[model samples]
Target: MRTNTFLFTVLVISIPYSLSADSFTFFNYYHDHMVLQKSSTGTTIWGQSSKVNDVVHIQIDNKEVAQTTVSSHHIWEAKFTSPSDNTPHTVSAVSSLGTIHISDVLFGDVWVCSGQSNMEFNLHGVLNATAEFADSANYPNIRFLHVHRQYSASPLTDIDSVDAVWNTPSEKSLSSFSAVCWLYGKYLSQHFNYPIGLVETNWGGTRIEAWSSPDAVRRCAAFGRKRNQYSQSQLYNAMIYPLLRNTIKGVIWYQGESNAAHAYKYSCQFLEMIMDWRTKFNTASLGTTSSSFPFGFVQLAPWREGEANLGFPQLRWSQTSNIGYVPNGLMQNVFMAVAMDLPDFQSPYGNIHPRYKHEVAYRLYLGALGVAYHETDVDFEGPFPTSARIDKSTSILTVEYDRGLHPIEVRSYNGFEVCCVNQTTTFCNAFDSHWINVTMTSHSFASISLDVSSCSHGNHVTQVRYAWRESPCAFKQCAVYGKMNNLPGPPFTYYVH
Candidate 1:
């Protein structure tokens, strides 16, 4: 068996325990040629090989596309992620020694999830512990590649993997994989039944900056505002850049608890990361042309509620505000499914890690189905309302949605605190829907349009909101929705919470 003994952690170097790559005990071989997106830059054929420096050649769309060099740590990663004209094409790669050859690679979508403890929370302890789970063993199609986490001050080309492989969910592997990703994958599989791959590159307790590249963040003023976050790109260099050309669906992120304190800046920086990731890959990086690059994410769930010290509500509000700042992109729909509503599931104290992981995965699934699959017929909970405009004369709050079928329904916001424009920015202590329709005085714009049918015939309405002390829209319990079934129900489909 091969082992890597590190001498110093400053550089986070890996020392070889054996000369032969296959001799390593932990990783048998990476399941390769995972995600090949349509119009991807260069096709990447990644996976573990028999030995280090094993030459790999890729053939995609009936053409030879990539060649790779294995790092001394015995890691093999290569990409030819350029997509060609949105056509379905097959890809194949063979090792020089003929030890591995993977065929039938299709160009579709791929996404990577990397962050801190919240992002790293696994499935075992959360919802359905493996002991209680059914036999959900292999989905050879939905490849899962587990990345080894490395922390250092400087940039790194590659990181070593001791254990993990591309396989379907098993009793053994189900526990280690991200509970959120599992749900997302389950949704993807059930929604489209396409081959899904999850490249788990997250680390516990790490900051968001550690996941973003130094160069990408430096371009934005928001990232520059923080001193330490800008200084390091080791994780980015080692993890993200290497996988750029690899075909991936859009991202499904679950992060931001660590950055909750600085909510305003996260709005700007988070948008930057989304744009940067798109720009790094497709020709039309910013919008739907990049297959709409469905960048959905789980809104931060209920945690640290009513805490005197922790700013849980504020953090969640900042998270929900992502819809406002990101512009046009819809919120990744989950919150309810992951059942943060279950009273027993919550920490009940100051705890960031919630036990209800199944609900988290379920919510992610609903999100993937809504965005990536565009399964509008399925009636998934999705595409939350991003903007609500109150029209005085018409007595209608014309609301435009970020996604989903047009002509959406706007209702009372669950969690909101009224901030009166009259006072000196002092917020009122109220548990009411902040955004509501007020009978406009009618001297305003005569052309304003709202979903006029839904509003009451006549009443004095000023604003609308999913109001709570925090910004997330929840009413009955600390969390808005509960139970796995309600996540995809018609009533909870498109609320602002």
Candidate 2:
């Protein structure tokens, strides 16, 4: 006979932990201290059962709510109206063979946060990490489910592994959790005074195509038949497919560096993926039918040095479908966090990953409050050009801005550029462009005046752009910003119109 001894260190004090998956067990996402979406359309509970044709009863607070028979595939599912209240409740699933119980279950808004390394940047990597970790225990209602990274050629019905169970925020659990997801959930918890669930499903060094489905990629005309077979749709098969049956509030994404080389096609591919996700999520048996759910993302952060002509600026433009802002003509029900000013050249991880995740998450929360929750009091976006024109009489280009709830602050007029049209060709090119000086308007307070006297060479200036470079300015020192919110103006290039 052989004997084995084991020692365990318990970090979660409230959860009644269980690691065994038996004849009747819920999916990996449902467990103690888990949160289900509080939807009027109802919520679905599913699990695997060995006994086919056997009935399984689902109860809340020991009161029977719904029941279903086990299918031939050894699976059982039951749907019921989820409670809107955020208070904890006890849930149990009973069968002829056994009974499975999960305590501390809460009904609340659940968000899926997905992307590449930037979204995978953990809490320990952010600034003031120790202080943040110490204060994490204060928000007990904010929960997290960190999905283990995986890739598959085909869709998965269930997750292969879980990095951590549905866990309440703590130093131990948050050390490796997504920083952007945690901070955004913390903001929501404080504002709504309720439970908030965040699902972290992301991988490092992955392109947008890998996160998108094959059907979505094929819909993109730019990638119709030229898509690479190695990594295309692999991450989505394993990571996102298994969660299609789960209802979610929205999604927050932070990716794009890996696809910078093919930045020109990003607009087509990204938009198609968003539409595909909305359509699929609406049609799924257990997912929500709200097809226009809010989607938010972080724009690429500045990188000091990398491949030449890597198209970071172009990729940033492509992120917005070349519109320079979300909720535009190209995309709706979407928002973005401008990260052009956050350049972290000394980060231990790499120059591409910035350490200012707290600010990014805060901005994302503001967008959620406005776009998702439909709160009109908060300004979710930074300053942007509402209109522009060149004063031929004064040789000045006055750009009017729609500063959302804040006044424009011009720290330095560094990134203003004017396209001087060539005399012979009657067309403007980058070679003919030159840096221009700009000043704050004393009268409007939301507008800037640029000196375009030097741009006249038998042809007047035809275009203008700002912060159109890999590293636009020093860290947090962009030329334009929102004075109160401290949000940098998004990078843009547009003709004078």
Q: Which candidate number would show the highest lDDT if scored against the true structure?
A: 2
Residue-level lDDT of model 1, residues 268-310, one tens digit each, is 5565565555555443122222523566555555554444332
Give the TM-score (vs. native) of candidate 1: 0.63
Which runs of model 1 end up more than 4 angstroms from their true locations? 1-42, 46-109, 138-140, 220-231, 281-292, 308-314, 320-350, 378-414, 421-497
lDDT scores of the candidates, listed in order: 0.48, 0.79
The candidate scoring highest on TM-score is 2
* 1-497 per-residue lDDT for model 2 (tens digits): 21212121111111123324347888787889988888888877888777889899999999999999987767787888887777899989999879999899998988999998899999999989999999998898888899998877767767778999899988999989999999999989989988898999999888888878877777664332233322778887778877766878889999898888788888877877777676666555354546666789998988874433538888999999888988776678888889888889999988888899988998899888888898989777878888778889888788777784235445666777777665554345333434353443332457777877876657667678878778787877777777456778798776885
Error of 2 at 10 (Å): 42
Q: Give every collision pair in model 2.
A: none
**TM-score of the candidate numbered 2?**
0.89
Q: Give the per-residue Cα lDDT of candidate 2 at 72.
A: 73
Per-residue lDDT for 369 in model 2?
A: 86
